[model samples]
Target: MKWSEICIHTTNEAIEPISNILHENGASGVVIEDPVDLTIDRENVFGEIYELNENDYPEEGVYIKAYLPFNSFLGETVEEIKQSINNLITFDIDLGPNQVTLSEVNEEDWATAWKKYYKPVKVSEKITITPTWEDYTQKSSNEIVIELDPGMAFGTGTHPTTVLTLQALEKYIKGNETVIDVGCGSGVLSIASALLGAKDIYAYDLDEVAVKSTELNIKVNKVQDAVKVKQNNLMSNVSIKADIVVSNILAEIIVRFIDDAWTNLVEGGYFITSGIIQTKKQMVIEKLENQGFEIIEINELEDWVSIIALKK
Candidate 1:
């Protein structure tokens, strides 16, 4: 029982796609260490404090780490991951140094190493995401707690992109509205929607692993009846009219489905988009506007932007 820890030195803009490549290559779990966390100011509105170790982070670029089982094909797997990350450059993604290194660890160490990086995080005014292995007490009567495992999935529902989307969902969803979640990694948004009183939800992902992960998380949250999980490309052939269409993915992918999102949303319905780097934020905004969506709000966290628009 041994594991190979693959660490990639890359920029913050490359974290999402690189982590995705690792998961698709059968990595068990992914961990991100960004130097910005060492000095970034966090608002205490949610009473969440971070205790980060400077030694664990890179001085300039971010570190994207994933665990792969030690096996005969480990070398090939690592090569494929490297090539996939390099291909990201074609999409205009910055790769920084792109230096990759590996280390060996026992199964016991690998299992517990990533856990230290995750904790209960208050993402929005009413929503707090906590790992299943952690015990969290609600701070108020109105607080909502989401227990997530994020096993072999994308994130623990505490990433800035996810937090922004959850906050937008909390603000827009009144109650009992149908929600369509595109690129629903870890099912966090769909689960949050159900907790926010969404009546019916459709969660779709191009990756089968993501679809399965979403299904498992939905059941864990006891929202199985509210969310229907499926494996599909971004909004392809989706004809259901929804009150809210939410997606947290690359800005490029988000722009590709702007038309589909506009068509699937009912009049005055909302569209929430995240996972957008600051440079591409304006591009997504223009695409949404061209699709006849009225830009409602724009919010940013740690250089990640989320936009909320209404189909008017």
Candidate 2:
């Protein structure tokens, strides 16, 4: 099977509205590239941290890039996907040729192409995510290395949500605490919690891919003895209240599930809510406040923010 990708380059300013439009129009997968992005590779540390000039902004508006896989059911050729996307986007600029680029790849090509990017990703000053295929010999023995081979799942310590949660875990985690990683993608949060000294960690995800990915990650990281992974929605069958709850779900989901977040946290426990874009900040905050959580910090990066709160 061949996989095709569509690029809709838009501004950080206009991306969300266009994204909502595409999603409403039945687009499934979307990855964003901000105006600040000077280059391609998403994992590069240079362009991400480089100081920007004001001239980077589009004079008219932003770009919206959407990736549609190459499949017949997606209404045939890349041209068709582009037509549908254009209808939804209501934009004028053509992204050069290949309004939607279609690439043919066999299973082996897909496996290798994605697997190439899965090298060692250091989450914090201490923890490192090393795929089972990679070597961690450069680090000292005292360093905490999470061996993860995440395939078709969300978390891999690359996204800001996972990184912020790891930072929060390092600070808020105390000895012998029960941790619940709601929406645990690739088990990054759960493994980090266990490494940070949590007595028990329960990782749950609504997606089966996430559940399986996290389970594999736990086994690879040698935390299978301590961390448990299950395919379930957040707090569905949680019996013992947790000392720390970490959720990196979408802003609306966090708002909708704030009560469940509160229910999982013990008295004076910490809850970290990430995957929040800048626009939905107030809605999530108000919901958390109403649910008896006192906001501790709003950590921001690249127009994204993570809310860390404590149960009142």
Candidate 3:
């Protein structure tokens, strides 16, 4: 089978949103090549050695690549992706040089090429996200390991947005609390919640691939009993009141369901939201506040922001 590689050359600020656009359009296994990474001083802290080739990266900006099956609709898919990315500017997101290009590749080549971009890394104080194929051990007694095979899911559990949400979950989740994970891509948040001592977790995503991926990942992490994966549009039909509701999705989509999230949370319940670019931060904050949620904590990592709020 043949595959089409869609590569977008944009600034670091646009990486998260562009990656999301690709995933939403049915592209799988994204590869991010950031020139900044070539200049970072790793110092060997994570036990992984870096041997980067400067020529492989763009002279400026980063390149995000994803693979989609070569089909009759490939042209339409690519155009829609471009339009979605162009729409980001309205939210005040800075997309530098937004040049897009495509190429054809063999299925075999894509199967292994994207794996090199993933590795085990500690995203928070206790959580370390490791790909299913990597070998890693806990460096501390309190360390929690999350094993994931993201497959075609939107998140690999290591993105800053996801990391921020996990950190917030660790800080806010009390034992035996019920948690709802909206847009539970790869089921990482729900799995993390269960591991953090939540008695029950409801994981929801509109994408069928995400639903299946979450189910598989929950089983991989041995948290199937505690986490339930489902296909639902945000919190639309969810009727259970939860102690905490967490969502790592676009700030625009996050605002659309603020009322639903507030309605499904018990008094004093927490709402943790990430996947917010810095530009849309104010819009999301205003929506959460308008829904009667008091701002509790606002966390930022890179260009991403996570806002934690409490029901008033």
Candidate 1 residue runs with Cα over 4 Å from true position: 1-104
Per-candidate TM equals 0.70, 0.68, 0.71
lDDT of 1 at 155: 80
Query: Which candidate achieves the best lDDT against the true structure?
Result: 1
lDDT of 3 by residue, 1-312 (tens): 998989999989999999999999997668899988888987542325477899979999999999888999999999999999999999999999999999999977756666666788887888888989899888998898999998854557777788899999999987899999999888999999999999999999999999999999999999999998889999988899999999999999999999999999999899999999999999999999888999989999889999999998
For residues 69-169, write the lDDT of model 1, one tens digit per residue. Answer: 89999999999999999999999999999999999989777566677667788888899998888889999999989989888457878778888899999
Which stretches in model 3 have alpha-carbon errors above 4 Å? 2-50, 53-105
| Span of ten consecutive residues with least summed lDDT in model 2 | 45-54
The candidate maximizing TM-score is 3
- Per-candidate total of colliding backbone pairs: 0, 10, 0
RMSDs, each prediction?
10.1, 8.2, 10.2
Worst lDDT 10-window in candidate 3: 42-51
Order of candidate numbers by lDDT, starting with the best = 1, 3, 2
- Give candidate 1's error at residue 163 in angstroms: 1.0
Candidate 2 lDDT at 271 equals 84
Better of 2 and 3 by TM-score: 3
